[model samples]
Target: MFTIARFLTTALVAILFLATLPVHAQDAAPAEAVAAAPAPEAEAGELDGLENPNIDAATLTLRLIPLTAEELEKLSADWLAIVRASTVDVVDEQIRINNTSAELVEEAARARLTEVTESRRALFDKYSTILDAWELKGGDAAKIAGYRTYRSAIIVEETRNTDWRTLLAQATSWVVSADGGLRVATNVGIVLASFLGLLLLARLVRRTVRHWAGRIPNFSKLLVGFSALAAYWLTLAIGLMVVLAALGVNITPLFALIGGASFILAFAMQQTLGNLASGLMIMVNRPFDEGDSVDIGGVSGTVRDVSIVSTTVITPDNQIVVVPNSSVWGNVITNSTASETRRVDLMFGVSYKTPIARAQAELEKVVRSHALVLSEPEPVVRVNALTDSGVEFILRPWTKSENYWAVYWDLTREVKDALDRAGMEEVEAGAPPVVAPPTGVAAAS
Candidate 1:
């Protein structure tokens, strides 16, 4: 389609150039001889009579170059109407060929189709030739330019769709022709080279972003990864468009199509977009990072990955869960590893008659003995509650975020053993059993 339109336009320019050339003195004798020559008669039942006088007037008007913008526009409108009528005629002829069983009738309908198509091409060519001259002469009105733009678009569209077999045959022929083959080879080489160059450039950009991101204060792994990945893709996208434009490919239509498609997709993918926005917010706010223990929307796990649409979490029991970013952001996000140090809270009960002072001392001793526990904050062990069957002591110990679970579990076991060794009796059977901390502490993500 593209090649055919260019060919027609080129042919039109050449014909107009020859017609406008000045006659030489030696050629003047040809005028009298040409006037004396008889006009040829039209062939019987030929389809050429289908030409409209309005189209003829428009074609004749195009011979006068550098017309005022308004006159050019009027001529453009006349040609556009003729072009539309020709399209309708072609469709009507195709239907005539389809509905008939007579071979002669189908053949004749095809002949009319060819004539109407040629007439449409001529109208386009003449109008385009004039418009090119108008613009060259500095008649650059927006409406005049619009006519040429729409004309080319329609020509390209029709050429592709009018006949697939003919379009394919032309395309194959062009691909094998000397000039066309050379042009195709050049473009292919350009595209291949551009792709390789852009790929390397994108990778370099990603590495650069990652290196720079680490130096940024408070930038988390999630933010760094997202930025580098985004930079990589963005570089490729812009670079490809630049390469295409340099190759004489028009990208404006592609952008327009993408804009239209985005408008429709906005409504269709509302939830996904919500997740994307939430993911960005999560990254920006620095609520959590990769490997952080998080409890979001009732799922407790280590954050394995964070993407624009979803968060992948690997649970302690080895289950992988994917939560949408919207859910992650919308819920209360508890990041246990977000802080440098975390407090492990525990509750244990014993017989009410047990010595409170002795138990407190024993619990404190067990906490302080743990290797990973931090000492600056000082562990706290005190009688917290008087239950129906026993007394409860609350033990709070500070430790590095990474060793929180180890510290909590170790102290619980060690404290139990220590108390028993010291002859501490268990709480009555009705009392609550020794259990891990509440859900808040367990997830503390």
Candidate 2:
């Protein structure tokens, strides 16, 4: 416990010390500046964050002259005004000491000219630093200290130096530069070759998957389609990364940018992404396929197209309806044509006096005789309910899915006609109740 307290006390002291540092630095900065005692050459580095270039000139003045900071500031400002008012180019001109009668030799004249030229070049370079900073950084507001300066001077110098052939030759030389052609060609060729190879491989894999999927019924459509798309796109994505690496591009920043963009897009398209996810689930589960008649969300139609985001359904009237996959997956889907066979439910009524056994037999015989009805399951007819109107008998039959509607209508018409021919009464569906003679009482005389 004592050791822990000691450790805590030390930590608190460290924190307090850190918190006071910036305050002390701010307080001390002005006092140190006031002291103005120039240290060694290394101490000249203190003149930072000066916006006016004149401060830089004053700093040079301070380095050269032993003046107090106050006097230096005033003197530098005065000198800056004096320098700005006058053209300083005269300082770079050759000093012509009147040398009559071989007083100054040719060699001495050449040396003086070289010194003058060097001084002019140095002055021009110093002035160009501001312009170079702007141009190189594309007009960056912040000026960097001690950057290389040449562009502004070169541009001015070239106004009199324009020779189209010379410019073309220089540009040509740059094109064939050792760092240009070989590296770029090698990098680009590698990216292209790798991409092409990957695409071919993906295509091959897709074809292989689809080859096997073709033998299966209704199971392989979604699997094969998505697999082909995924193979190609996944290969493309991986190839893109490899291409970036080959081109000496940093992929870390690319990934970070893509991640940020993806977050925003996913959030903005939440419903769309839900639909996309639901589409994938639909494909995997094989709920319905293209060209199947389905009843989805109270809308019955033939599925014309199934895409990742939405399903297109063509209604019986040839009206096209597009539904989001999210809605389709969330609601009940009745795929009418998915199965090989379908059961047709139909109802007919008869008088209660009619023999239920005989009625049931005749109904069954009528349904079985239909060519579209399947024989394996066998048609069934039975008295399902008895109402005040009549005895309700249901006829249930199995038929090929394609023949469902046709068989239903045909059997209905044929059954009615055959029953009438047999002199049997079929109680019309939903008919009112019949009133019979009460208690068999004798009629009034």
Candidate 3:
């Protein structure tokens, strides 16, 4: 009876101790929970800032303007996380809408779906804002594959669910909306301003290059023209890229795409590329110019135009010949009009019985009497050789290149007439009186 009483006393004390402990612990737990939990209003405000549909792209862009690249990256990560969560919510709401049949429940699900969809759209815009900021800081586009993939997925999801009519209506509303209209107007203004600026800069560069190039004695008209045009185009190209970058457009990808395309084209257009390089060399070296009579690649004609791929030549008989620049630069180039004066050579033969001194005198007189012949370097009239036909006399006269053919033809007729009048038997009908050779130095007069 004594042992049973002791056990009951100990058990009674233990039960009393346990009952008091719960009251004290319960009191402390609420204080700790209160300290750990955030304020509901503050948490709601943070979420609303990111998910607010009222925020436009322009507004977000302005807000992000002051952030650094690292800050933008961090913010981009945050917006991506938000977008992901919103995407999940949108998916869940869509499933709920599809699974329900009750009218009120389906309507409620649709409303939730619309809300989450709008929130996701706003989240995507904010994410794009961060990406724009990052690109403006010279960030590479390839580094943001994750960001792009999610945005594209969201777009695909919306496209799959939304009807075309709803999509069109939404597009029209966005275009008419104040934010969208302002953004469009601003971009248009920037483009117009850039275009005008480019025009002005190109004009300025053209004038500057022309003026500067004109003073350089060695620069030909062709080179000067090429230089001025090249400078003008270069200025416009560089300005356009700068304006694009300033408008937050990433042009790095464009360069990469162009580089890749050029690499492939280089192989396919090997001959064209060769001509282009040869054309450049022709321009730089300036072996010939427009209107110059040239013997290039065995084609003798006046150069009409030297384009990037080929040169246009008009022959003496009015035939247009187009020769590839590669062939032109590779072959020998002979410019006939490069000199100021040319030598007109004519040879005359007389009978062996005819006096050599008299024939020489008649040839010299005919040459000197020509109006176009130069008098400074006296005419060369002498016996050059004694051929089987007769004794040969050479008549060499100098004249301006422009008057060369005129003097040549005129002297030929006059010498023949004089020889006929002199009654030389060798100057018969079958035997020719004048012989002009290619070297412009005839063995005979």
Estimate candidate 2's RMSD in Å: 19.5
Question: Which run of 10 residues does model 1 get worst, by summed lDDT?
Answer: 22-31
**Candidate with the larger lDDT of 1 and 3:** 3
Off by over 4 Å in 1: 1-179, 428-445
For model 3, name the residue pairs that clash.
346-445, 347-444, 347-445, 393-445, 394-445, 395-445
What are the clashing pairs of model 1? 334-445, 335-445, 336-445
Q: Rate the local accuracy (lDDT) of all candidates.
A: 0.69, 0.60, 0.69
The digit string of per-residue lDDT tens for model 3 on 1-445 reads: 6445444543443332232111111111222221112222322233335344456777777776665655555556666667777888877776665566544454445555655665565566577677767667755344454455556545655545543333333344444544344555676799899889899989999999999998999986667777898899999989988887786666876788799999999999999999999988998999998888899978999998888789999998999999999999999999877788888887777888988888788778888888899996777887777665778777789998778789989998898898889886554322443444678575754
Evaluated at residue 409, the lDDT of candidate 3 is 91
Models ranked on TM-score: 3, 1, 2
Q: What is the Å distance of residue 342 in model 2 from its true position?
A: 2.4
Put down candidate 1 lDDT per residue, 192-258, tens digits, no spaces: 9999999999999999999999899889898999999999999999999999777645576688789
Badly placed stretches (over 4 Å) of model 2 are 1-170, 181-201, 213-220, 351-358, 387-389, 431-445
